[model samples]
Target: MTGDAEPASDERTPGRRRLARTVLTGAAALGAGLVSGPGPAPTATGSAGAASSDATRRRPAGPDTALRELAEGNRRWRTLHERHPDETSTVRRALLGGQHPFAVVLGCVDSRVPPELVFDQGLGDLLTVRSAGEVLDEAVLGSIAYGVLELDIPLVVVLGHQSCGAVSAAVHADLTGTELPAHMQYLVDRIRPAIDPKLRGDARVDAAITANVLLVRALLAAEPELAARIAAGRLAVVGARYELGTQWVHRIG
Candidate 1:
């Protein structure tokens, strides 16, 4: 019995040693940036499992993967399955070292359409920029450029939402020829070109909303900094719309 036990113990010792070596090798790889760490893990909750599924998924390395992450997040949000991942103290502290956000979301400043909530992404997952009616200014453009040029974020999503007050206001001003207040007029002026004078009512407003998104996307894509990345296929620019009623976000451009 002792002789049989000795052989079994010897066999197990080598297996354990091999397992330890493998673990150490993997750890070294992670430390060296040769392997990416898993995304944030979520706390336990009924709806968290689905949201947290993304946390376990690999980090998005390019535009396509980043867009897919956003789509999945939006689905979880619309389905009432938001995981709200990566808001933990640990995740926050870890981010102090640096942020590695994969995408830039440029959306409306409307309180109801916060890009983070609409996409169901937590902190450090997205670099978000907002303006009324999704209008772009020099500052806003610079911010987006920083995300792409400095941060090397791969995807830029120009997000427009339904019933956007800014767009509606712009459309109303266009139809009536009533000038909005100075600053507000700036927003209107930016959005005015996209409005179709022939269309009226909700249809006009809706078309303007989508057109604004496309316009912003085009401007970003044409920027010298962003254009190079697009030409190299290292980046993508997309336009999407968020429905207030359904909480659904669909690409329009």
Candidate 2:
């Protein structure tokens, strides 16, 4: 995994090219805010199958193994390395009917930051929910609840990344009182309360991002169904920050 932010269109198919272009063009409108600042964009190498296999191999045993697997995957990713696994026709055929994903990842909607690629997961390995800033809304929280209460996903990860534009916007709102677009403003509102008032200056954006992740984790852990599972030791909710410079996910509180 490389630390740089690559265009999301690079890995999509030709049939989806036009759609992707439209998506990229209207990213902000779609409420998928852009990434701020700059770093070397990481290039995705190897086939999806290979990546998935590596993810599967790292998976922990039982219904509650996602946290460890994710940690290991991030380690592999940080080194500009991958443990490519073969995605054979048999494997594809086997997954035709259903999927039993081990973990549910609630992440930012940034195109440069796709959870599957970052975690090196393959088809049917993860249940992913994405929204700007990883902010918790009724619908987003319900989706995560479904994964836990119904799908029985073992782990829930609130994944934030460095240089997140959504977070930066929230920080801006906190400091300068600048308002964001109407639709996107909700994200700021949801994340705003989580921002640490004591923290200030340029680095506040990064701090806000991590703060939001911690907030999401707390929210998930407190959710009724999720809370039950957690109390029973059947599930875990963890917060992580992905470094754009190293392509590694740093586990935070």
Candidate 3:
């Protein structure tokens, strides 16, 4: 992937155009801060499937700022006061040019943890990738690299949630020693390192969940491109836990 920064902007990006799930309407105000993307965007809920969306402002200046923005958003979400920052028509038209997302969030495929809604971000504001248990392989790595190396995003967040199906399945498979289905075995094997042989019940699942997030976060941080950026203090890799019980996002690493 090549950097999509325009001549006039210090940073910019045009993501893979994947459909993102929309939790709240009008939260796509992604153009106000700095990031840009082609919008009016589309949420994962259209007439046939995903719906169309307008963009909004609330651009974060850099990595630290981006993290802060996410934390505050999560607070709003936790308290049920989500401002739903950037989902307006003006925000939509503004991003017609490109995107300059401040952060790249690697989250789970769990529907409840949609990064945009969990962090209260909007259109063009985030470059997000999802996989069961937040697993990392070639394609996932490429997506993260594209956002960091090519798109100039300064932060990468590995977000794991409570009672993750992937993690729970992995734990169950490990305990029962039952082989999972063809494709699912791939995920089960990948999450093995995060399992705790001594733990059981919710504790076991939770342990693996956190372990998986840290594992992925470390993997991304150590990657050649991200490592160099980290060495230069230009990029940061973090791990976070999104709680379904209270709609809170906690920094784990």
Candidate 4:
């Protein structure tokens, strides 16, 4: 269903309309932006799989490969054939000393969208950073830089999802002209620009969520160190969203 059904006559009241609009728009809204080409993933230097010399012992072969692997994993997850790879005792032991994750996943703090589970990644496969609505600051950017500059992670996936509470709250607050709690106000304020003020209800929230993903994608891609890596064909930064009902994830930007 498109979830665009008109409300009852009485439900068209301002408060009722606001409530209706606050509901999240699902995968129907596809966020848009530029998606950079993938780059080669750096070699794993740790002792775990380094000694075996098996390609599977390490992360995916390259940035493009990493993205492809995630897409395949999502297919498995949605199909109920999740490989759930690389969680064995030996794999855990190998990761004890250090981690050489293939990708850095920046996702919302929403429980349903855990990067590893949604992408079907194994232990040490992803460096995940989550904030309400995926908002970023100096610290978050610093962490991402560490993943790129230090760990040499080849892919950065900004994962948003359907019905984000944070985005919904921001949309509702914006439309109602109500300020949230201090810290929450900060988050809603950051999310405002991504949404159009003229839009109301679910359309507003859906648009904001997509905008948030693309905005974050551009922000990370423009980071000085990350920009260098992208220019050198050593990184790929992408924006994607997870469909709650379908268990599928697709790139939006």
Give candidate 2 misplaced runs (Cα > 4 Å): 1-59, 84-86
Q: Please give the lDDT score at residue 170 for candidate 1.
A: 92
Candidate that would win on lDDT:
1
Clashing residue pairs, candidate 2? 4-40, 4-41, 4-42, 5-41, 50-85, 52-122
Ranking by TM-score: 1, 4, 3, 2
Instruction: Write one digit per residue (lDDT tens) for candidate 4, span 3-59.
Output: 222212221111111211322222112223212222232333344444343335546
Using TM-score as the yardstick, the better of models 1 and 3 is 1
C-alpha displacement of 229 in model 1, angstroms? 0.4
Error of 4 at 143 (Å): 1.1
Any runs in candidate 3 off by more than 4 Å, and if so which?
1-58
Which candidate has the highest TM-score of all? 1
- Clashes per candidate, residues 3 or more apart or on different chains: 0, 6, 28, 2
**Greater-lDDT candidate between 1 and 3:** 1
Off by over 4 Å in 1: 1-57
TM-score of each model, paired residue for residue? 0.79, 0.74, 0.77, 0.78
Q: Please rank every candidate by lDDT, starting with the best.
A: 1, 4, 3, 2
The alpha-carbon RMSD values of the candidates against the true structure, listed in the order shown, are 18.6, 12.4, 13.8, 10.2
Whole-model Cα lDDT of every candidate shown, in order: 0.71, 0.65, 0.69, 0.70
lDDT over C-alpha atoms for residue 95 of model 3: 73
Clashing pairs in 1: none
**lDDT string, candidate 1, 1-253, tens digits:** 0011111111111100011211211111111211122233333355445444544546689876777678767766766667786776566777899988898999888899988888778879899999998899999999998998899998888898878899999999989999997699999999987787777678788778877776777777777777777777788877777778766666655
> Could you tell which candidate, 1 or 2, scores higher by lDDT?
1
Worst 10 residues of 4 by lDDT: 11-20
